[model samples]
Target: MKKNLLWLVVFCFSISAFGQAPKHTFKLGESDFLLDGKPFQIISGELHYPRVPKEAWRERMKMAKAMGLNTIGTYVFWNLHEPQKGKFDFSGNNNIAEFVKIAQQEGLWVILRPSPYVCAEWEFGGYPYWLQNEKGLVVRSTEKQYLEEYKKYIIEVGKQLAPLQINHGGNIIMVQVENEYGSYAADKNYLDINRKMFIEAGFDGLLYTCDPAADVKDGHLAGLLPAVNGIDNPAKIRKLVNENHDGKGPYFIAEWYPAWFDWWGTAHHTVPAEQYTKKLDSVLAAGISINMYMFHGGTTRDFMNGANYKDISPYEPQTSSYDYDAPLNEAGNATEKFRQFRSVIEKHLPAGQSLPAIPAAKPSMAIAPFKLNEQVALFNMLPQAVKNATPLTFEDLKQDYGYVLYRTTIKGGKQGELQLKQLRDYAIIFINQKRAGILDRRLNQNTLSLTLPEGDVQLDIFVENMGRVNFGKYLLENKKGITEQVTFAGTEVKNWSMYGFPFKNINSYTTKPSAIQGNGPTLQKGTFKINTVADTYLDMTDWGKGVVWVNGHNLGKYWAIGPQQTLYIPKEWLKKGNNDVAVLELLKNDQQILKAIDQPILNTLKKINVE
Candidate 1:
C-alpha cells in the first residue's frame, strides 16, 4: 500500500512538470521582459528559418543563441509558404512548425513577425509575384482585392502558428501585425484588417506592429502593442514608445540595421563592427528588447531574387547572394562583426545568465573542375506545331520561370536593322545557328543589325526571365517573353516557334558527345572534370551573355561587363569529381571557353554607364 502511494505521487509530479508551459509575456513600461509576471530582459536576433536551408536552420539558430540571444525572431515569408495564389507549401524548409519546435527545444523563445510585407530586401518585399498578376492588386494598401488576398494569407498562416502562441502552451511570444505600414502609407483600414485577421485565425497572443519612429502614429493599430524599428537613438525610442504606446513599458528595437543589402552592380557593402557594437551597447544599456535586422543573411536562390527601383535610374536587380554583411554571413558562418556584437551583448546580460559556446563552423572542401560534353541544338528540339502560330507569352504555354526559346526562318538575308519590339529584358539573336548579335533591355537597346544568309535562313532567339520586376508602380509591366511586337527590318515576322524552357527540367536534356555539332543556332556540349572542391567562379567573360548551370543548379546570369561577372559557386555545391556544367550562351563567339577561379562575389566586369 505504501509503494502504490509513492508511485502515484511520482506520477503526479511528472505530469505537472511536463504539462506546464513556459511562463512568458510582454507588458508595456516593464523595464524587464516579464515571465509569469516577473521581469525579464530579452536579447534577441532575427534570422528567418525559410531563408536558411532546413538542414542548416538549427545550426544557425544555435549560433544565434550562443551569441547571447534568448529569443530567435523570424519573419514568415508569405510568398515562400504560398508561391501560387491558393496552393500552399509547408514542407521542407517551409516548415514553420518544425522551425518553431526546434527553437523551443533549444530553450529559446520565438518572436513571430508574419508580415505580409517583410521587405527584408526579399523579392517584392516578400509579397508573392503571383499577387502582382492579380488584376488591380494594390499591395500594402486597403484595395479590396489586395485586402481579400492578404486576409486569406493571414488566416492560412494563423492556422499553422496561432496555436503555437505563448498563451497556447507554445514558445511564440509576440505576433507582429502588418510590417511598417505607416512608412509607406497611413492606411488605417489595412493595418486594422491585418490585426483582425490574426485574431480571427485565433492568434490570441500579444499583438503588435513595428514601424520607424516617424511613422509610428500611422502604423499603430488599436488593441495591439506598438514597437519601434530602426531606432539607433535609445532616447528617441523611449519617447516614441511613450507617445505611441501611452508612455508605457516593454519597448523594443524591432529591426536594428546591423548591415545593408547589395545590388548587382554595386560594390559589396560593409559597416564597421565598432559602429554596430556601440549602438548595440546603448540599446542594451537602456535595457530595451532588440532584434538585429539579419543575424544571418542567406542566399536568395534561383529566380526568387528581387529588384530595387530609383526614379532617376533604371531598375536594379538584387544579386542571388543576400550576404547583407550581417553578423552572420550568407553561408551561416559567424563574421568578425558577430564576435564583436557577441562580446558587447554578453556585457549587458542581467549578470546571472551566461552564453553558450559557439559551435564549430561548417568545413568546406576544394573541388576540381568538371566538364560536360553533351550538346543538343535548341532549334532542332522545337515541337512540330509552333510553325503556324504567333509567338506566345510564358503564361499562354503554362511556363513559370527560366529561359524560353523563340525560333523562326527568315527568307531574306540579314542586312537591315533588327528590332525586338518590347523585348522583355534580354535576348540573344542567332542567324543560321551562328551567333549574330545581342540585345539587352538594361541598355534599353533592342535593335541590332545582323548579317543574314540568303538560303533557308534560320533565326533563333533565347530569352531569359532574369527575375520578374518585384516592386513599385511599374509592376504591371512585368510579363515575360516578348510582351510587345517583334520587328525585323520593319517587317513583322509571322509564324514563329516558341519553346518554353523553365530550367526546371534541366536534367532531362540528354548529354551527347562534344563533337555532335550542327549548323547555325546549334547547342554545343562539352565536359570538364574536377578532382577536388573549392570555391570558384566560372569566368563567363569569353562567352556572350547567357545562363550557366553547374550540377543542375542555375548559377544565375553571367555577362562580360561591369555587372555580376563571377557567380558565387559555393563549395557546398561542388563535388570532388566529375561535376557537370552546362552553359546556354546565347551569343557565343568562337572564344566560348569557360574558366573557373576561386571567388564567390564578383565586381570587376566592365560597367555600362547607364546615363
Candidate 2:
C-alpha cells in the first residue's frame, strides 16, 4: 500500500512538470500577454529567424533566455516568404512557423512583427525586387497595385500563423501593424488600410504600431496600442505613452539599438559597452519592457543585402554581412557586449527568479581550399537566340536576378562612336565575343569607339543588374537589363537576339572549350584543390570585376575597387573533400591566381588597385 502511494505521488509530480506553459501573460486595458497572467514584464530580445540557421535557432533562443529575457521578438521578412509574386515558401530556413514553435518549446513567448516592409537592412526593405517592374507602383502607399499585392502577402502569411496565436494555444502575444510608418510619411490612410487587412486576415490578437516616440501621433494606429521604438530616455518614454494612451499602461521599447551596422566604404562601427549597459539599466530599473534591436545579428547571406539612399551625390549600398555590431556578432557567438548585458539583466530580475546558465558556444570548423575542376564557358551556354528581338525588361522574361546577353551580327566595320542610349547600371561590350569595352551608368555615359573587322561581325553585350537602387527619390528610376536603345556609330541596332542567364541555372550548363577565337577579353577557367575544409576568403582584389561562387552559393560581387576586398566563405558551407569554386572575371588578359587563407578579414589580395 505504501509502494502504491509513492508511485501515485511520482506520477502526479511528472504531470505537473510537463504540463506547465513556457510563457506568462500580462493584461493591458483589454489586451493580454498571459505569462502566468500576473503582469509579467517581458525583457525581450530581437533576432530574425531567416537570418540565422535553423539548427542554431534553439541555441540563440536559449542565449536570450539565459540573458534574463522572457520573450523572443522576430520580424517576418516578406521577400523571403514570397520570393515570387503569388508563390509562397515556408520550408527550409524560411520556415517561420517552425521557428515560432521552437521558441515556444524553449519556454519563451514571441512578439511577431510581420512587416510587409521590415527595414531590417534587407533588400528592398523586405519588398520583392520584382515589384519594381509594375508601372507607377508606389510602395507603402494607397496605390491599388501595391495594396493588392501587400494584402495578398499579409493574407498568405496570416494563413500560416493565425492559428498559432495565444488565443489558439500558441505563444504569439502581439503582432505589429506596418513598422514605423509615421517617420517616413504622414499617411494615416495607408496605416489604417494595413491594420484593417491584418484584421481581415484573422489575426485576432492585440495589434500595435511602433515608431519613434515623436512620430507616434502620426504613425500610431487608432484604437490599437502604440509602442515607442529607439527612445533612450525612460521618463520621456513614460510621458509619451501616458499622453498618447490616456493616463496609465505598460511602456515598451520595441527596438532598442544595442549596436550599429557598417557599410562597405565606412569604418567598422562599435558602440562603447559601458554606455550601452548604463542605458539598458535605466530602462530595466523603470520596470519597463524592452527588446534589443538585435540581441544577435546574423549574416545577410547571398545577394540579400540592401542599399541606403543619400540625398547627396554618391549612393552607397549596404554590405552582405548584417553584423550590426550587436551583443552577438554575425556568426552567432556572444560578444563582450553579450556578457555585460546579461549581468545587468540578472541584477534587475525579480528575487528568486534566477536566469538560466548560458550554454557553451557551438564548435566551428576550419575549412581548407578547394579547386573548381569542371569548367563551363559562359559564351557556350547561350540559349537559342530570340531573332529580331525587342528590348525586354526582367519582368518580360519572368526572370529575377543575374546576367543577360544580347547578341547580334553587324554588316560593316563601325568607326564612329557607339553609344548605349540607356545602359542600366553596368554592361560589357564584346565584338565577335571578344572584349570591346565597358559602359558604366554610374558615370552616366555609355559612349565608346571600337574598330570592328568587317563581314558578319558578331556583337555580344553582357549586362548585370548590380542590385536595384533600393532607397531615395531615385528609387523610381531603378530598372535593369538594357533600359535604353543600343546604337552602332549613332545608328540604332534593331535586329538582335537576347538571352537571359540567371546565375541559379549555372549548374545546368555543360562543359565546353573556353577558347577565344576572336578577341576582347577572353573567358578563362581554372581550378584549385583543397584536401581539408576551413573558413577562408577568396582574394578578389587582383581580378577586375565579377561574381564568384563556391559550391553553387553566390559569394557576392567582388571588384578591385577600394572597399570590399575579400568575400566571406563560412566554414559550415565548405566540405572536407573537393569543393568547387568559379569566377567570372569581366576584365581579362591578366595573370589570375586566387589564394585562400584561414581568416576572412586579413586574407585579401596583396595588390590593391583603385584605378
Best TM-score among the predictions, by candidate number: 1
Q: What is candidate 1's lDDT per residue for 49-167, written digit by digit as tens?
A: 75576766778888988888889888898878887779888897789988998998888889998978777666666777677667777877778898898888888888788767777
Off by over 4 Å in 1: 1-23, 30-33, 383-392, 408-422, 449-459, 475-477, 488-496, 516-599, 602-611
Task: Report the C-alpha displacement of residue 135, candidate 1, in angstroms.
Answer: 3.5
Question: Tens digit of lDDT per residue, candidate 2, span 95-199?
Answer: 998999899898888899996887777766777877876777888789999999998899888877876676556788889998888777778888889889998
Cα lDDT of model 1 overall?
Answer: 0.72
Deviation of model 2 at 20, angstroms:
14
State the C-alpha lDDT per candidate: 0.72, 0.72
Worst 10 residues of 2 by lDDT: 602-611
TM-score each candidate. Answer: 0.83, 0.83
Q: Could you tell me how far off, in angstroms, the CA of residue 136 lies in candidate 1 after the best superposition?
A: 3.6
**How many residue pairs clash in all the candidates, one count each?**
39, 20
